[model samples]
Target: MKQVLVFLTDGFADWEASYVCAELNKPNSGYQVKTIAVDLEPKTSMGGLRVLPDYDMSTDLALLDIPMLIVPGGTGWSDPINVQAKELIQHCFEREAGVAAICDATTFLGRHGFLEQHNHTSNSLPDLKLGAPNYSGDEHYVEAQAVVDRQLITANGSAAVEFTKLILEKLNVYQGEVLEQWYGIFKNGIISA
Candidate 1:
């Protein structure tokens, strides 16, 4: 079973994070989903919803050896806890783990020097400089969705529901009827069996 790790923090975007997990957890999807947080207790979402984390950051993610990591955006970017979160992200990058960050969290990738010369985007471009081939769009999410350059895969924001769908596609879950079903859901906002 392939595993996906969601890096959760206080004020994380609930819709983007939870929706991705829920979609990937579909029956026969072959993905094992887990949420990791800086703390062990439940964390509050930007919408004030509480989300229970499956593990703490201190826990060795090596056991699961996740193939992907999803980072959802929120005010947590400015919090001090982001320091450690950034380190973990760097570690994942070093290990060749596929990473996706939505909204402001995308800035974290820029800050860590991980996106140099790679096309990328964030909710708001920060002053922190990077040399990546970045682009920003007006849409809530970049329609092109996940841009895979080498080992890096990035999505602009939540506007592109296809972001997670691309991950599933890469994992070999979004094929044939599954791909069609995902497209229908994106176009009509409904999922059919």
Candidate 2:
């Protein structure tokens, strides 16, 4: 099973990763979702859930071993102490691993120039520019729920379902009508018999 790393930090917006993590973590999904943090310490979500990370930054992982890195939005990204998280993200990117970021985490990526070259989206174009002062991807920014450019997947804060769809598509976990049905079920609560 391929490893899908989800970056977790204190004050993370837990719900942003809910659908994708749940789908990726299923037994038949052929993927293992593990939470990573700067340390082994338990991190609290914005929703008040405390999560004990499975791995820390110093833990050695094989190059390109990760298929994707899921980053959720949160106020924690505002904490300078978590800047070390950038290394893990850079490592994943260096290995060509898909990077999925949503909400303010998108801002974090924008601030770091990750979104500058990729077609991406966030909570708002103006908000992204405001949060990421150095962001220069205005032309690449798409006004949509989510945008996937190559291995990079980005979405707005309210587009968890859309975000999951793109992430699954990039991972090749689901395709065609099956993917759309899954989207319908979660996005619209319309499960077919």
Per-residue lDDT of candidate 2, residues 92-171 (tens digit) = 78888999999999999998988877899999999999999999999999999999998899999999999999998888
**Cα TM-score of candidate 1:** 0.80
Give the clashing residue pairs of candidate 1, or none: 117-132, 141-159
Cα deviation of 142, candidate 1, in Å: 9.2
Assess each prediction's global lDDT (C-alpha) against the native: 0.70, 0.91
Number of clashes recorded per candidate: 2, 0
* Residues 1-193, model 1: lDDT tens digits: 8778888888888777665677779877788888888878888998998889887878876777878888887778768776678767877777888787776677766665665656655543433233123533223223354566555566666545756666666667777787878768875778795
Q: For candidate 1, what is the lDDT?
A: 0.70
> After superposition on all CA atoms, what RMSD does each candidate show versus the true structure?
4.5, 1.1
Task: Say which candidate scores most in lDDT.
Answer: 2
